[model samples]
Target: MGASGYILRRLGYGVILLLGVVVLNFLLIHAAPGDPAEVIAGEMGGATQEMMDKIRADYGLDKPLIVQLGLYLGGVVTGDLGESYFFNQPVIELIGARIVPTILLVVAAQMIAITLGVGMGVLAARRPQGAWSAFVSVFSTIGYAAPVFWTGLMLIILFASMLPLFPVEGMESARFSGGPILYALDVLHHLFLPALTLGIIFLAQYARLSRASMIDVLGADYVRTARAKGLSERKVTFKHALRNAVLPIMTVAGIQFGNLISGALLVETVFNWPGMGRLAFDSVLRRDYPTLLGVLFFAALMVVVANLLTDLGYRLADPRIRTGGSRK
Candidate 1:
């Protein structure tokens, strides 16, 4: 129940933060100098002044800026994001359709990051003075410190161009119907490059953080107590020290997940993945305001939701979080 209350409180805060981001999205797009009608209609065809005027009226674009913003915000609260001029479809629908691939990419990259980072950190922690620890530290540093675009390009050049081991770009081959199995395989093939790129960024942070946290935990009084009690070395590290060492790493990792959803703009662009990062990049180029705003909103929503989940995870992983009972 304490954890539940903490989650509820965190969710409430997330909603408030989401609203601020939404309002900022609206204002930034609306403030960008060129008229929305001009941008929207120009993309559709060569929009005439009269047509542009009509479109503006249709979208409430001619309303006082504040009034237009009010309606947009109100409509957003009521679950309408307006229609896309380019797609001739509900903006929500377009975003919804594109979101799954992006979510998958984020999740995949996240798993890779956590697995590699935590594993390496734990390994390094166990043998602080060993060659294995040194090697893991160096590899993780490269993963973290390397620029994402550079890493992505290097991977493509190594695997795709030189070795001919993987495809150069895209989420799947156009040849298949994107079936349950074959499609999954094709996507995995296509996704490997971009996921690796994103995973490298995450891996670096996790490796460093987990290693540091573990090192610190090893020196804690409880850890010393456990060791002095004649517990097996494995039991000392895994059963006892690992749990507490992981708390800070988990907290930082949760925040990084938010970044992966937003931070892959370059990676998506490089690989031509049809994720929201790429969609937003394309939308910005075309001045597709509705699509851009919708994708941005989705990204914001993802960030908040990830943070909330991380908070829940914190409680589950570390009993001390809930036992202290300051939540609600």
Candidate 2:
């Protein structure tokens, strides 16, 4: 199929997947023990029947499950995510406000992970049995196995407490007022530690994937032919081998982006970063159904979109797959 047709198909599939996600999230949230109305009533003082009933009626919780689901699905179609019971704001607006920080954190972390991972993988692949290779392997394994929150704490202690370099928590320094460039720098300053914590957690997978892919690509006949033809080592390795090997790394990176968002929840909680992950965390704590559902819907949508982009990227990176060829 043509590129447009391919994209259209993917978009349609994405819509269906998002709808499924909404239904499943709705069901799951409702299935969980505890009534949102009761929780709200208790917070207001006591869960008397009158208070509970009024709360339920206010939020449509009194409606039948199927009817509530239908209403929610209808609102989703109309771009209305309902209101946040705890925050007393529109769910979409609350999510929209926090999404920026989450995106920044995720993008920064991915860039760090990919750059370090791919570079180390290439270096290790070049000298598979060397000391550097062994070190990379060991470090990557440790990075992969470490818990994200633990990593964040260690970073905070070492960087924020001991050395006193980056801020221990938050998206920016409260004391600073500056222009766009300065503001960007300030945000990056606070962002570095959490981003690094998240990046380190994901880096190992990419490093391992890249190393394996590079080793396999290097063994291919074309690479040997390129070397035999007196091509420079750099050209043979990068132009011939790395180019072909990057496809798998790209795929892993795309999938990991979704995982990283989930991981960011813990990282954000640890660092007290104001992001959607933290928002989701708060929503869950308060049993705020609308806000939690909104976050889940957006998170699932992002993953679906990332997967679609990854497929398109595959076609662009390797022309063999552009004409509806098998990815394999």
Candidate 3:
């Protein structure tokens, strides 16, 4: 297959995967023990049977499960995600407003993870039995093992409480009114802790993966041949070894991007960051079905796209993996 054909095939599979996610999410959300109508009714003082019936009718909750699912799928075809009962706004609008912060958080975290992880991995690979290597090993192990929520708390205590360097909760300080540059700086200032909290775990994984990959690549025949030809150590390590080793890292990084988004749910809750993760947290608590379903659908879509990108990255990283041979 040609590149276009390969892309088309992947897209087709992505659509099918997304449809499956839609059905599963719909079923799971419906299966959960809670009535969205009841939650809304509780918020409005108490509800009579007539009031409850009206509320159910308003949101199409009175419809048969299959009929409701059909209606939802129809709405999805036209780019409608229904309305949020609690927010009194379109689900799409609610998600659109909050998605940026989440994206910013995830992207910042991934950048930190990749840069430090690859650097430390390369360093550790260069001197496997050295102090830095041992430190990397121990640090990565702890980082990978530590719970994300716990990491956020520790960062808050050390950075926010003790040092008083970064803000504990929020994407930006509400009191700041300055130029765009200063505003950007302030946002980054508030962003540091949360991003760090989210990134550290992934950084450990990347570092460990990169270190293992680099060590294996260094032992390969091609690397030995490059070194035997009197190439500089830098060229032999980077140009020969690191280039080949980076493919696995790229694959992991792509998959981790999706996991990072999911992991942000707890991180966002801990920091009170107003992102989709926080929205998701709120939706679950309030039994906001529309918002919850919308978030799940978007998350599934992101994962599918990430996986597709990873496959594409494979072909780019290794020319031997041609589009025709990669079709599945």
Candidate 4:
């Protein structure tokens, strides 16, 4: 299929997949042991039987499961995710307020992981027995082994508490008022630790995978031909081999996008970052069904979109895919 046709096909599939996700998340979340009305009533210091019944009715929790699901699906179709039972706001509004921070965190983490990981991998692959290779191997091992929350805590202790080089928790300095540039700088400063904590594990995986892929690519006949043509070692490795090697990395990165968002739950909790992770965490604690469902829907949507983008990227990176090799 042509590029346009290919993209349209993928998008068609994405819509169907998203619908399935919505139903599954709704069922799974409702099936979990909890009563939203009870949680809300408890927060209000308790309520009478009539009050609890009214609460349930108001949130439609009194309805049959099928009715509730039908109603939710109807609302979702109309761009209404219902109001947050705990936050007392529209779920969409709540998500809008928090999504940007999560996006920033995720994007920043991906960039860090990809840039450093690919660079280290390339360096190591260049000299398989050199000191840089040894360092990359050890770094990847420890980084992959460390728990994300532990990494965040250690970073906080080393940088925020002991050395005091960065803010301990938050997306910005509360008291500081400044220009856009300075504000951006402040956010970046707070972002560094959380982003690093989230990215480090992925960085290790990328480093190892890219190193292996690069080494294999370097052994290919094309690379040998390039070397025979008297191209510089740099040109042979980077201009030819690296481009092809990146295909697998892109595939893995796209697939792992979901995991990155999920991992943010722990990272954001530890760092006290005001993102979807924190929002989802709060929603779970309060049994806020609408809010939780909204988060899951959006997270699933992101993963689906990421996969589509990965397919497009694969097509762009490798001409064979674009020219009808496994376009489906």
Candidate 5:
């Protein structure tokens, strides 16, 4: 299909996928071994049957499962995600307050991972047997294997505790009042560790993938022809090979966006960043179903949008994709 048609088709698919996600998340959250009414009642004090029953009735938890699901679906269709049983706020408002931090964290992490990973990968590809290549290999292995929370902790210890380069567990300096520029800088300082923690594994992944793709692309006939024409090694590698190598990287990056968000949950928890991840963590403890559902729904929406953007990027990067052809 043409670009417009392609986008329209993908959007249709996204809507359907989101619907399925809503239903599935609702069912799975309910099926988990806990009652929101009881949890809320316990928070109020000891949970008597009368109090729990009243709580359920108040939140519509007293309804049949299918009926509740239908009501939720109906609310979702009308942009209502129900009320937060714990926070006593609208679900949308809670998510709206926290989504910015999560977006900033996710986007910052993505940029860091892609830039460093591709750069290292390209460097490693240029000299497969060199020390740099070995370093990249080792770093990738360790990064890929390490848990995100552990990475965050180690960073906090090294940077926050020992060296004291960055703050350990917040988004900004609470006492500092400054202009927009200084405030932005302050936030970036806090963002570094959490972003790095979330990005490391993906960075490792991209590095390995890019290195292999670049190596393969370097051996292609087009690359050989470019080099044979006396193009500089730099031109042959960067201009000819790297362009093709990055296609696979883009694909993987898009597919892994969801995982990146999931990893952020751990990273945010470790760093105590005031993002949707932290909010989701709190919601789980409070059995705040509406808030939790809203987070999941938004997260899924983001993933779908990311994938669509990735497809458009593919069309931009590869003429064959634009023309819907394998043969150039």
Candidate 6:
């Protein structure tokens, strides 16, 4: 198929996948044990039946399940996330405020991990037995095996508590009198620990994947022929092998981006960073249905988008893909 045709097909599938996520989110949240009204109330004892009835009626909690689901989906289509029963605030507004910090953190982490990982992967594969390569391989293995929360705690102990070099938790200094630049610096200090924690956790996989891909590509007949034709090592490795090798790495990186958004639930809790992951944790604890649903839906969207990009990477990596619709 043509490029536009392929894009249209992928986009159509993406829409279907996203809608399924919305449906699944609704079903799962509904399945969790609790009355919609009482869950919204979230520890009510002194309230009257009138207050409960008003709350239910006001939020459309009194509607039948099917009707409510339809209304929820409709609202999503219209970009109305509705009000959170637990917080008594609009869900969309709340998420908007929290998403930026999380996005920045994730993006920073992605850059660090991919740069270091792919670079080291290429170097190590080129000289597998070199002392520096061995050292990196050992470090990468350890980093990958280590638990993220454990790494965060250790960093906190070593840098934050022991040396006082970085903030222990939270995104920034609460009482800082500084403006945006200083505030950003403070946030970066805090973010470094968590970002490194995530980066270290991811670096091993990227490096290992890239190194293996590069090695396999280097041994291919084309690479050998290019070398026989007297291409410089740098040109042969980077211009030729690296481009083809990176396609798998791109796929891995894209999927990990989505996983990072979801997986940070633990990291956020550990660091007390007020991102979507942390917000989702709070919503679940309070049984705030709208907030929880919105968060999950967004995460699902991330996964769908990530997978789509990975598929697109196949075309970028190899021209043959443009003709045949296959990775080859």
What's each prediction's TM-score?
0.91, 0.97, 0.95, 0.96, 0.96, 0.89
How many pairs of residues collide in each model?
0, 0, 0, 0, 0, 0
C-alpha RMSD (angstroms) for model 3:
2.1
Q: How many backbone clashes does candidate 3 have?
A: 0
Query: Candidate 1, residues 1-328: lDDT per residue as tens digits?
Result: 5656777788889889988998999899878866667777766778888988898898777889799878878878988887876676888998887788888888888888888888888989887999988988889777777888899889988998689878878888877785699888888988877887888888878888888899998998998999999999999999899988888888988888767987677788888888778778877877778788888888889888888888788888877666875532
- lDDT measured at residue 21 in model 6 versus the true structure, 0 to 100: 87
lDDT, model 4, position 83: 99
Q: How much does candidate 1 score in TM-score? A: 0.91
Runs of candidate 5 exceeding 4 Å displacement: none
**The CA-based lDDT of model 1 is what?**
0.83
lDDT of 5 by residue, 207-227 (tens): 999999998899899999999
Segments of candidate 1 deviating more than 4 angstroms:
177-179, 228-230, 325-328
Model 2 agreement with the true structure over 1-328: per-residue lDDT tens digits: 7899889998999999899999999999999998888778867878778878888999999999999999999999999999999988999999999888988888899999999999999989998999988988999999999999889989988997699988978998889988999999999999999999999978888888898899899999999999999999999998999999898899888878789889988988998899999889888989999999999998897788778988888889998889756755
Candidate 5 lDDT at 277 equals: 92
Give lDDT tens digits, candidate 6, residues 107-158.
7777778888999899988987788678777888888889888988888789
Clashing pairs in 4: none
TM-score, cand. 5: 0.96
RMSD of 4: 1.7
RMSD per prediction, one decimal?
2.7, 1.4, 2.1, 1.7, 1.5, 2.5
**Tens digit of lDDT per residue, candidate 4, span 1-328?**
7788888999999999988999999999888998899999999999999999999999999999999999999999899999999889999999999998998998889889998999899989998999999999999999999999998899989997689988879999989999999999999999999999999989999999999999999999989999999999999999989998898999999988999999888998999989999989889889998999999999998889889988998888999877766632
What's the residue-level lDDT of 324 in candidate 6? 84
Off by over 4 Å in 2: 326-328
lDDT of 3 by residue, 17-61 (tens): 888888899999999899999999999999999999999999999
